[model samples]
Target: MANPTGSSLLVIERLLRDRDGIWRQIIEERDLKQLTVQMLTSSALSLALYGAVLGASNGPLQAVSSFVKLPLLFLATLAICLPTLYLFNLVFGAKLSVLQALTLIMVTITVTAVLTLAFAPISLFFLITAQSYPFFKLLNVAILVLTALVGLRFLTAGMTALNDHQLKVASRPPALPPAVELPADKPAAAKENGAVLTAPAPVKRLSDIGGRPGELPPGERPASMTLLYIWILLFGFVGTQLAWTLRPFFGSPDKPFQLFRSIGGTFYADILQTIGRLIGG
Candidate 1:
């Protein structure tokens, strides 16, 4: 097994080039420490990249806030969504272990952070050439949206790959070995008494309902789709709300440096208002 702690770059490389392999490693090894390390490293670098761009317009203090905000957005969103995701996976028969689930989410965040970092140079270019606050804010918003979509592609693909792997494993026939008989003395006493204790009932699973392992019932397909849609919505909602809570990454031209703006409007409303002011003024 590769040492996940010794090198974060190797993990990132595997994530980009061999996602299925990384997922298998995480599942087989039952390790998340490397994933956690990667998340922290990627998030920190993303903060620095974002701060570099924001510092061009917002000054040192606002740049510092940029450093703080992305981490807040990532961690807060994860904290808010983790429980719901775990429950949905449990109910929908995903068969993910706790470590597997945590690593999957960590991979998503790390990928997003890396993608954001990749866009930093472009953001800096706009910061230098475009002085309008709306332009800067909108541009970064667009960059984040693109990065998020790419990152989410990994999440969906990873889920599908895991499901496929599960099906392959489940479809294989179990090997049957010769059975051993119970000792004659115990059986004889039980037969004379005319009493036999029933065997313990097997625990039921969501996947066991009218289907083999890794195969869902016909009705369950729609429920799984619904859960996926809800999961996507929950991710977006939490991220947007957390971003709002950690406001001022672009820093307003009129206002002085402050860590947060008063929470009053929806994120979408604010974006529209910024766009209108940029165009009208």
Candidate 2:
């Protein structure tokens, strides 16, 4: 039998093994090069689709319209990406190629209509709310959900890429046995628990990853947690609508000028807001 002290030490190492080493290995194994290509291409395609739909629905545009719309088009496509990624990750724990994943998510969102229902009302409220009370408005939860969804796409692009790698390795010919056995030193039932240490918990020190200490384990999320996040964001924004009154910071009776009425006033308002934003930022 192995030395009692050595066996005990080995047991301790095995206990913390996955949280340290196995997790990092899974993240580093994804197809990063493919992922980068997928993100850029996916973003571009989604943008083109939005611009086309908008242009078709709204009206034919002037020659300069495309140029003016470039940014907005990108923004719309980004909207499509958010919930698509969320639900896609929710349903499938594994990752897919860029186009396959994007299309899959797009279809998923189209079928569920959750993003449509969620965003449309909130968007209408945003427009009306700003027109009604432009100043000192609270950042409600729907807005937060929208904001998080945008941020989430960026977050998950990295996540999907990381998972893609691990899934590939996991799909490979089985290199490790199932967790159904234990080492000889342990009791029969304990041995049946399949004690295999693939590798020592990663040496996560300055010399290991060049990162500071106490960093949380990276990319350690599950599908259910992501769904919970969406549900929370959904409720937060929708809750704002229930508030009976919204206090306004700007109460202008300047003949109730429609923001779309004057080109110069609209332009000036946008610029002032932009400058104010710079200061706030």
Candidate 3:
């Protein structure tokens, strides 16, 4: 058996260096179980480390709480939103299997987690040097939002590629019958019920069907892409609300450490307030 750590490292390297190859594998349904395991392991570890950094602002206990909650936050959001995306795609004729959908989502989460982990050192530097709670909180929020956008971009690209590949395969012409020999005087025409029939026009490539090569015809874009966009928005809203529900990930220095906080205000309201505080001070 191969070492799991080495396998995961190779997976991550491939993710960063050869994302298109990964997408192809996903479309081909290759090594899905192994890919899922590697992605889950790497993302969980990365998010845990970043969560520890977020919690360190308060103390050891909060650090531990954050270390646990951080991974939970992302995974929980995935759990909440995964079903809607999968079902929506299915309703719109997507060829994705449940495992394929899950793996695709894992790709996004892994990218976000890894990017957040990359920003951990900068976050840690501020946690040590910066005293203002609002500044630190907003900075981390900005980082999370930025990384999540990047991950979502990857998700969108993967879905597009998958859809294109499926479309191409579907459009492909099957094996043609052997050409029937005819005398030099005979035309490739036949009389069908007194109506002359000629060989059907050659099938056009998908790229040539539309005005521009490699572009879908006007108003003929897959409904699944629109569904995916809506799902992305839904994912963002759900994640923010869930993060709010699982509050106190970053324990404020002024307040004593608490595992959870009373949920009264909205996440947006809190962000506006934080912005106000930072600007006012």
Candidate 4:
């Protein structure tokens, strides 16, 4: 039997260093359940660790709250948006299965979580050295945004890879029948009025004509990819709003620790308010 620990480690290693292989697995619909489980486990742990750092700015109780909420934030966002992505692809003639879609999104989340974890130490340093709560909030927010962007880039790349693979498969020419041997006595070329006639050169297929590797032909990209890009923007909007809704991740230093805060302002407005406070102070 395969060691579960080793399998999980391998999955994380592949996510970090062999993303192309992961994309291939998703496209091929191989071991999707296993991939999803491993990704979820790794991302949850990473996000929880990062969340602990964010909450550490307040106190231990807030740290525990963040450790729980951070993973919930990402996974909840994924749950909310997963159906839209799958249906969008389905409506646009993409053959992506639900499992495939889930795995792909997991790829995004795992990357984002892992990258955020990598930034945890820096965030912890700021937490210790910087006394201003607003500045610390903005710093962590910036880190999350940067890491999410990188994760979304990976998602775009994976979709592009899937589209290219599909195009190649679709453009493949039908197999021709084996040629019949001609008699030695017969002329290789047809004769018309004692003039030799030859066949015209075979037409080259669009697939046969090559350009730069990994680039799709003009107008060949599916509508699904475009929809996916738009969906990513929607994802950002949804995630930020959700984060605001699940506030108190970084409890204010001035206020007593609370598991949740009253929701009133938009996330962008809050950021602006925080920026103003940061600047004024």
Clashing pairs in 2: 21-202, 29-165, 30-165, 141-237, 142-237, 181-191, 181-194, 182-191
* lDDT, candidates in the order shown: 0.72, 0.36, 0.85, 0.84
RMSD of 4: 5.9
Pick out the ten consecutive residues of candidate 1 with the lowest summed lDDT. 216-225
Pairwise lDDT winner, candidates 3 and 4: 3
Q: Which tens-of-lDDT digit does each residue in 44-133 have in candidate 4?
A: 999999999999988999999999999999999999999999888767667778898888889899889988999999999988898879
Give per-residue CA lDDT, model 1, range 1-281, as digits (tens): 85644466555666887776776766565456766676667666775677557645778788877777767778888888988888888787667766676777777877887778888888888877877778888888998888888878777776666666666665555555454344555542243357553333445654566676556444433125467668978899888977887787778767788888898888988989889998998
Best by TM-score: 3
TM-score of model 1 (CA atoms): 0.80
lDDT (10s digit) by residue, model 3, range 94-203: 56888888998998999999999999999999888988789999999999999999988889888888888866755555456556554467577866579675665555
Per-residue error for 138 in candidate 2, Å, reads 17
For candidate 3, the lDDT comes to 0.85
Clash count for each candidate, listed in order shown: 0, 8, 0, 0
Residue 182 miss distance in model 4 (angstroms): 9.8
